[model samples]
Target chain A: MRRLINRHPSRRMKILLGALPFILAVAIYAIAADARGADGPDKLMPGLNAITSAMSRLMFDIDRATGARLFWADTWASLARLGVGLGISAVIGLGLGVPVGFIPCLRALFEPFFAALSLIPPLAVLPILFILFGLGELSKTVLIVFGIAPFILRDVMLRVAEIPREQIVKAQTLGASSWQMILGLVLPQVFARLISSVRLSLGAAWLFVIAAEAITAEAGLGYRIFLVRRYLAMDVILPYVLWITLLAFAMDYALRQAHDAIPWTRFKEGG
Target chain B: MMAVIRLDNVSKSYGETVVLENVSLTIEDNEFLAVVGPSGAGKTTLLRMLLSQEAPSSGRILIDDAPIAAEPMPDRGVVFQRYSVLPHRTVIRNVMTGPEWLAAPFTGRVMGRARAALKSRARNMLDRVGLGDHATLYPAQLSGGQQQRLAIAQALMMNPKVLLLDEPFGALDPATRRAMHRLVLGLWAEHKMTVVMITHDLSEAFHLGTRVVAVEKRRHDPHAPHRYGSVITTDFDAKPRLARQIARAPA
Candidate 1:
C-alpha cells in the first residue's frame, strides 16, 4: 500500500488527516470507558452517553434550588467577572504603562515597585484579597485584576519603550508638544499592543477567576467543577473542563480575528 | 546674500569625550551646504545642533540671526538616514503628518477642507518626488529608495524654512541615489529653502552643494589622541573648487 505518511496529503486528504487524531482520541476514551464499565459500571471514567446526558441536564434543566439553568448561569457569571476584571486592567495597564514608559521621573518612581510586584505570584495574594475585600464579587474581580494588571502594564511599558529614537526625534521636529507626542504617537500604537498582551494574559485571568470562584462563589464554571468534585462524577467534570477549554479557545480566536481586522496592528502582532 | 543661520565658536563634549570643537560658520539664505567627514568626526553633531536635537556645550546657534530654541520645531524639517515616515500610515498620510501634526490631535483622522488641503499638498509633493502612484502604500511596502522619497515628501509638507538632511539618500542604490540627488536639488531650488546636509559622498557634496565644509580631528599627541575633537577643517565656496576638480579629472 502507498503510505500516506511519507507523501504530502492533498487538501481533501488533509482534512481527514486533521480529524484522524480527534477521532482516535474519542475512540480511545470510549474503549477505556467500556473496559471500566465492564467491571464496575458505576465508574470514574464516564462513557460517551453518560457525559452527553449529564451535559444536557446541566445545561437545559432548571436547578431546583435557584429556578435557573445552571450551566448558562455559571458561564455568564464567570464571563462577567473576567470581562470586568480585564476591562479595568486594560485601563490601568495603559494608564500606568504610558507615563512610566515616557516620563523619566515616573519611570524612576514606579518601575522598581511594579517590577517586584509582578514577581509575586498573584494567587499568593488571593487570601489576603479575600480577607481585605471579603468573600464577595469584589474579591473575585479584584483577584483577577491583581493577577493580570501587572503583566499587562509591564507589556505596555515595553511597547512604549520600543518606539524608536528616530521616530521620537521626527515627531518632536514636526512641532508636536510632549503631551501631543505621548497622546498622539504613543496612544495610537499602544492600544493594539494592549489587546495582544491581554490575550496572552487571558489564560492567567481564567486561572485567577476559577481559583477565586472555586474557593468561594455562588455560581461559576469553577464553582461547579469544585462542587461536583466530591462525588467523582467524571461525566459532569469532563464536560465542564471541555466547555471551559472551548470557551477560552473561542475567546483567543476572536481576539486574533479582531487584531487582524485592524490595519495598523502588524507591529503589535509581531512582538 | 543674507546669512540665514550662524554658529559661533561651537563645541560639544560628553564627559571626557569630545565630539566637536571650535566650529563656526555663517549659512546664507537658500544656500545648499553639504558637510562631509570621516566616521566619528562630528558632521552629524553639527546638524543635530541646528535641528535642536542637542545643544552645543559652548556657544550659540542662531537661525535667521535669532538663537535657536531649546526644542525642535517643524520650522526646520529633516530627513534622517533612516526612513522617518511612520510605518502604519499610507504614503499620503505619512507626507501629511506635519500639517496634520500641527493641527490634528492624535486621532489619526482628518476631515473637511483642512484634510483636503493637506492631502492635496502631500499628493503634489509625492508626485514631485516620483511617488505619485504610491500614495496608498505603507512604508514597508516601498523599496529603500521609494521610502527615502516618501521621507523627503513628508519633511517638505511642512514647508520648512530650513531643511536638514542627515545622509538621507545613503541607503539607496547608486541609480536611486542619482534620482534622489536630482529630486532633492529640484526641491531645494524650487522652494529656495536653506539646505544643511551631512554626507560621506564627496561627489554628492560637490554636485548639490554651493558650499562644502569638511570636519576632521586635529592632530594630537599620540598619548592624548582623545584630547582634541573634530573641527570645521575646510569651509569654502564649492562651485569654483568643484569646477577645478571636475576639469582636472582624467577621462
Candidate 2:
C-alpha cells in the first residue's frame, strides 16, 4: 500500500472529491432550514422547495403590469450594459496601448499618466460619473468602462513592451517601417494578450455594472435583488445570486475556449 | 576585388564605459570574414555597427563607397544567437516576411500571383536550409537546431548584400553545429554575398572564413576597466588552407 502523501486519486475518485463540498453545503442548508421550522416566520434561510418555486414563477409567469418576464428582462439589461462597456474598453486598450508600448516617445509621454489612471479607485468617482452622464444607461456603461479600461490598457502596454528586443531588431533588418512593425510585429502579440487581459478583468467589470444598476436602474439583476430586500425575499435573492454565478462562470469558460483556439498562444519559449 | 564594407577608425563608448575603440577594416565582396574575440570584447557591437542598428560614437562606416544608412535596411540581413525568428508566424511565413514587406509597405502582405511567387521562393529557401518539411510549424515548436535553420532561411530570403551572423549556432549541439557549418558554406558559395560571422569558437573561424580577424584590448587599466576599449589586433588570410580543406571534405 502506498503512503497517504504519495497516494493519488483515480479520475472517478477525483470527480467525487471535487463534488464533496457542494453536497455538504446543500445538506447543511437543508438541515438548518428544517430546524428553523418550515412554518416559522424567520425567512433568513428559506427551504430549497421555496427557492425553486420562486425561481419557477420568475421564469414561467408574466407580470400583469408590464406583460414581460422579469427574470429575462433583468438578465438582458445587465448583459447589454456589460457588453457595451467591455467592447468600448477593448477598443481603447488596443488603439492606444499598441503605439504607446512600441514607440519610446509615446511611452514616455503616456505611460505614467496611464499608470496613475489605473491607480485611481474607480468606485470613488461613481457620484461624479452619475452627475455628469445622468442616472441612465450611459452612466452605468461608463462606470464599467472606468473600472476596467485602464487596467486592460496597462496590461496591453506592458505586454507590448515585454516583446524581446532581438525580435524588434530582426523585424527592422527585414525592412519593416514603423507602421509595418506595429501592424505585423507588435499587434499580433498584443491582440492575444488583450484577450487574456479582458478575461481577467471580467470580475471587476461585473462588480461595476452591478453597483451601477443597484444604485439606480429601471431593470437589472442588481436592481431586482435590491428591490426585494424590503420584503426579505430570500427565496428570490438566493436563486438570482446563483444564476449570476453560473452566467459569469460560463462567460469565463467561453473566453478560455476562444483563447485556446489560437494555436500559437499555447507555444512556450524554449532556450 | 571591390570593397563592400569599410570601417574607418570606428569607436563606441557608453557614458563612462568604452566597448570598442578605433576599429578599422575593409571587407571585400564575396569574402567570408569570421570575427573571434573574448567575452565583453565588443564583437556584437561591431556587428551592430555594420548592421546600422548603432551609430559609432566617433567614426563612419561605408558600404559600396557610400555612408551606411542611419537605420537597418533589407540590404543587410542578420541572425542573432537567440530570438531571431518571429514566434507568432509559422516557419514559411517567417521566411516570406522580408519580400512581403518590400512589395507591400503598409500591409506587409501580398495577394494573388505575387503572394504565390513569394510563397514559392520562401519554400525554396526552406528546402535549401533543410526545413522544408517543418514549414507549417511555429518557431517554438522547433528544436534549437531547427530554429537556427529557420532563422537562417528567414535571413537568406531577402537576398542581402551583406549577411551578418552573431553566434547563430552557439546554442546547438556539436553535431548540429558541424551540419550548420556545411549548410552556411554552401549558402555563401551559392549566394555570392559577403558574410561576417562572429563566434567564440576558434576552430569554427578557421574552418569557415576566407579571412579571420581577432579583436582585443591593447591596454588595461587596473582600477578602471572601461578606460580602454577593444580593437582589431589580428587579421590573417585563411583562404589557402580553407580551400585545400574544403576540396577534400565531403559535401
Candidate 3:
C-alpha cells in the first residue's frame, strides 16, 4: 500500500537499486553481443545501451538488490566516511563558531580570514593532503573534513551572530553566566540553522568522497566505476554511477526527514 | 531593612554630551520608585548604571551598601522594554531561568530536585500572573500583554530584592498598558520588593511610584561644557493627586 511505498529504503537497497542498471546493461550486451556479433555494429550498441538501459534497469534493481553482500559493504563504507566527516564537523563547528560569532572582536579578526580560506575549492586541496598523508584513509578523510568543516563553521557562525540581541540581554538580566548564555540562549536559537548547515555539508561530503575515492580508493563504488572505465566497460561504470545517485537521493531524503523531525521547527515561527 | 540602593554624585556621558550629572538618590526597602523624564533625558542611563550594565564616569551605586561591580549581583532583576521571553522555551522554563541560574548549589547544576523546585516556583508565579494555562506555551504564542506578565513572573521568580523595569508597558495598547500597570502594582504590593521603573508618561510614573524622580535640563549651554541637573525625587506617598499637580504645572 501507500505505507509500503513511503517506507524509507535501506542504504543497501538503494545502492543495489542503483547497480541494477549495470546488471541490465550487462544482460542486454550479453544478448546483443551474442545475436549481432562484435564483428559488426554490436559493440557500438553496448555503448549506447549503457546510457539508455541505465534508467529502467536502475528502477527495476531498487526492490531486488537487497541480497548482495558487496552492495551492503560499499554502502557502509560510504556512510561511515559521511558519518565521521559530519560528526567531526558538527562538534568542531559548534566549538569554534559559537564564541567566534558572539564575540565581536574575535569575529572581526577571524570571520574574514575564514571567509577568504573557504573561497578555495576543497577538491583543489587533494594534492596537499595526499602529499602530507599519502594514499591512506586519513588523506581521503582529511579532504572530506576540510571540504565540509569551513562551510559549516561559516554557516553556524553567522547563525549564532544573528540571534536576536534582546535574547542575549534578556538572558543576562535573568542572571545567566557567560557559559550558560552560550548553552541556553545561543545554542537553542541556532540549533535548527546549524542542522540545516550540517545537511548541506553532509551532501558536500558525499560528493567530495566520490572524487576522493576515484583518485585513491581501490574498493569503493567510485573506485569500481573508475576501474570499469579503463576497459570501456560502460556496463559496470554506468551501474555504479546510478548506484551513487540512488545513495545520494536516499541520504538527502533521510537528512531532510531528520531536519523536519526537529520539534521547534515543526511549530511555525510565530506560533 | 536598610536602604537597598544608594546612588551618589552619579554622572554619565556619551562622548562630550552629559546624560546624568551629580545625580544622587536612595531607595528604601520595598520602595516603588518611578523615574519620569522627557525624551533624551538620562533616566535609562541612571537605571543602567544602577544595574551595573553601565558604569558612570564618576560616582557610585551601592546595593545593601556594597558598590555595584562588574559581576552580576543576585539581588537584582531587570525587565526590559522589549518582550524578551525566549520564544522557544515554555513560559515555565523562562520564568524558572532566573532563580535556577542565580540560586547556589542548584545554580551550579540544573538537575534533580533543583530543576523540580524551579518548575514548581515557575508554575506558581505563572499562576499568580494568571498565565497558568499558557505555562507550556512559547513567548511567540502569547499576546503582548501576556508576554509582559510573563516577564514580570520571570523577574519575581528570582526573589530579587531590587527589581528594575524600563517602560515595561511602553509598547502595549492603552488598555493593555493600563492592565499591565495594575498587574505590576499588585505584584509589587504582594512581593514587597523595591521597584524602580523609568517612563516618559508622567501619569504612569505618578500612578505606580511611591516617589517619582524627574530628570530635566538644569542649564543650557550653546558652547563649552553642558551641565545636567541632579535628579529631583518627588514623594507621592502612593497618591494620584500629586501626579495631577505635576502634570498641571506649566512647562
lDDT winner = 2
Model 3 chain A worst lDDT run, 10 consecutive residues: A58-67
Better of 1 and 3 by lDDT: 1
When sorted by DockQ, best at the front, the candidate numbers are 2, 1, 3
lDDT of 3 by residue, B149-213 (tens): 98888877767788888888888899988888889888886777889999999889878887787
TM-score for the first chain of model 2?
A: 0.96
lDDT of 1 at A177: 74
Backbone clash pairs in model 1 (N, Cα, C under 3 Å; residues 3+ apart or in different chains), count: 0
Tens digits of per-residue lDDT for model 1, A167-220: 788887777777777777787778788989889998999999999999999999
Worst 10 residues of 2 chain B by lDDT: B241-250
TM-score of chain B of each: 0.92, 0.94, 0.86
**lDDT, candidates in the order shown:** 0.86, 0.90, 0.75
Off by over 4 Å in 1: A1-20, A266-271, B1-3, B104-110, B220-225, B240-251
Instruction: Give the Å error, residue B189, model 3.
Output: 0.8
Model 2 bad stretches (over 4 Å): A1-7, A38-41, B1-3, B241-251
Candidates 2 and 3 compared: the better one by TM-score is: 2
Q: What TM-score would each prediction reach against the true structure? A: 0.91, 0.95, 0.76
Number of clashes in model 3?
0
- Cα lDDT tens digits for candidate 2, A41-124: 457888888888888888889977768898998999999998899999999999999999889999999999999998889889
